[model samples]
Each structure stands twice: as structure tokens, then as C-alpha cells.
Target: MADIDLDNMTLDELKKLQKSVNKAVDGYQDKQRKEALAAADAAAREKGFTLSELTGGQVKKTKAVSPPKYRHPENPEQTWTGRGRQPDWMKDALENGQSKEEFLIV
Candidate 1:
């Protein structure tokens, strides 16, 4: 990635670089798919079909997503929620080396 110093490259060079790499390709594909799905949903709504109705009884139930727990980068302290009162145990754990990824997985 160090070879990709964009600031030093010419427009022609930049175009060449982009062509050779994915360059946010995954995000772009996801965005396009989302847009297409949104358009389909809107069309269905206009046709007086409820979102559930259009799914032909194949809708998947989804729960509200809970926020990820936060832990200190270098410590073991873990926080189930990043909001509200901070706990002393969490602070101590964070100081000990329990990272955010470890907290999330646990």
C-alpha cells in the first residue's frame, strides 16, 4: 500500500492505479445492491403492497441491533455499553489488557 502515495501521482497515474485495485469496490457493490433493494421496496409500496406482503411470507425477522461493547485498547477493562456510568472494574480491566475485540467476543 506504501506504493500508493496518491498525492504524488498524476491524474493518468491515478486512473491506472484505480483500474488495477479494488479501491472501495466492496462498499460500492454493497451500496448499489442497497439502492436496488430500496427501489424495489418503494415500487412495492406504491403498488399498495405492504413490505411483509411483497415478501410472499419469506421475510426474515430481525431484532434491533445492540451496540458493541467497548474495551480499552491496551487494558482488560470491558464496557457492555459505552454510555451511562463508567464502572471501576471496567477501568481496571482496561488497564490490565482486555481489549474491545475481546470484550465484544466474550
Candidate 2:
């Protein structure tokens, strides 16, 4: 491979380079996810249940409601998937002598 002289590269060449880099990064992320899933499946087998048997449609049927949208910390005008949202009430409770990990089943 020849040296990529960025100063001499055209706009099209720069776009191609950017696309290639994004593709390589996405490939790495996909490989990591595949390895993690394989490990989970193997662990399930060691526990005397195959991945399919352990799942058995049980994992897919959650009845939880969708969480509310949250204002982004960096950009207040923007919103996020509340998977990482810390509501003000929850934060206050934790600050005032409460533990977030203390959920009780009815």
C-alpha cells in the first residue's frame, strides 16, 4: 500500500477513506457482540439447558411500559432513550437515604 498523502487527496478520496474507517469500526463491534452471545449460549449449555431451551419465548415477552423521554445532559433541547435516564425523584431518593437496588416484588 502506498502512503496516503492527506494534503494531496481529493474530496472524493477523503470520503472514501472515511467510509472505509466506519466500515472497519462497525465490523469490530459486530464481532464483539457475536463472541458475547456465543459465550452466553455456552454457559447456558453448561447449566444443563441449551440457549433455545433456556429462552423458550420467556425472554421476549416482557410487559414493562416504555420509559419517558429524557432531556440530554449535554444538549438540553435534545432527548435520549431513558435506558440511562436518572429521574429527578429517583436521584433525590438516593441522595436522601435510599438505595436504588432495593426493589421489592408484590
Q: Best candidate per lDDT, number?
A: 1
Q: What tens-digit string does per-residue lDDT give for candidate 1 at 16-92?
A: 87876665787798799788777877888999986669889675556776664765445645445766776776666
lDDT string, candidate 2, 1-106, tens digits: 7787999989999999999989999999989978987898899989998777777845333387764454434445553334676766556656889765432111
Per-model clash counts, in order, read 9, 0
- Candidate 1 deviant stretches above 4 angstroms: 1-20, 59-63, 67-78, 81-106
Question: Candidate 1: which pairs clash?
Answer: 75-94, 75-97, 75-98, 76-93, 76-94, 76-97, 76-98, 77-93, 77-94
lDDT of 1: 0.70
Model 2, global lDDT = 0.68
Q: Which residues of candidate 2, in runs, are more than 4 Å off?
A: 1-8, 56-106
